[model samples]
Target: MDTNTLMRTLDGTLTCTTLYGHKYRSAITGQDRMPMALEGLTRGKSLWIDSLVHFTCPLTPQQETQHLSRTPVPGSVCLHTPEETVTLHERGADVSFSEHDVPEDSFLSYRPRLLMAVTNITITANEWQHTEEWQLDLEEI
Candidate 1:
C-alpha cells in the first residue's frame, strides 16, 4: 500500500489512499448576454467539469506495455487513481508519456476515475524491491 491519504469524508471517517497519483477537477462557467435573441441556448451554458490528472509511478517494462495497451489510441481513457475514479478522454493523445520522463520527489497535488464495471490493473515495480523500475510522468490524458 502507498500509505498516502488522498481523500476523506466530511466526518473524517472514510479515506482514500494511493501510492503515486493525484486527481484534480476544474469547472469553467461561461455566460453570454444577448438581449435580442429569444433562444435559450445562447444565454448561459454549463460545461462538464473536466479532470486534470497527474500520475507518476514506477513499473517494469512489461507493466509499462500493459498500461500502454490499456490507454485508448484515438479515444479517451478512464483513469482510476488513488484519489478518485473518473472516465476521461485523453486530452493530448500522446502515447509516449511514460517513456522518457521521471518524476522527482516533490509535492503531489491532490484534488479528486473509472466506472465500477471495469477494474483497473496496476503493477508497481519498486526500486527497493524489484531489480528494474521504470519511472513515468503521466500527464493529463
Candidate 2:
C-alpha cells in the first residue's frame, strides 16, 4: 500500500521484543551487550519509536530519500483487527531511516537510552490498530 494509507492503518502504538537490547546500549552500535526486552511505540507523526519498530512509523516530508538498509533477521511487528503481523523488511519494501534528533529537554529522551529517529513505515491499509501495544508478551513461534 501507499505511504499515506499505511500510516493511517498503523496510526497508534506498537510493541516489539527485538528492540529490548537497543534500549540499554548505544544506538551507534559499538557496545554489543545482552539483548533486553523493550516495548516501543509509534504515533501519527510527532513521535519516534525504537529501531525495531521504526520501520513502521509514519513518514515525514524529508525521509522520502532515506533507504531501507538490509536487515539480517528483520524482526516482526504485529497489529490487529485482521490479526495481522507486519514483517518489518520485505524485498523492495519502502522503509526510511532519516532521523530528527529529539531535544535534550524533550520528554522523548527522558529515558535511559532514548533516541528520536524518524523512520517511515508503510504497510497495507486493510489492517487495524490493537488496543494494547504488547508484542513483547507473545511467545516465540
Best by TM-score: 1
Go through the candidates in order and give each one's C-alpha lDDT: 0.32, 0.27
Deviation from native of the Cα of residue 57 in model 1, angstroms? 4.5
Per-candidate Cα RMSD to the true structure, in Å, reads 20.4, 21.0
Could you tell me which residue pairs clash in candidate 2? Answer: 20-38
Tens-digit lDDT string for candidate 2 (16-38):
33433332221222112323223
TM-score of each: 0.20, 0.17
How many clashes would you count in candidate 2? 1
Candidate 1 to truth, TM: 0.20
lDDT of 1 by residue, 31-98 (tens): 23322222332213322222344443343332222233222323334333344443433434323333
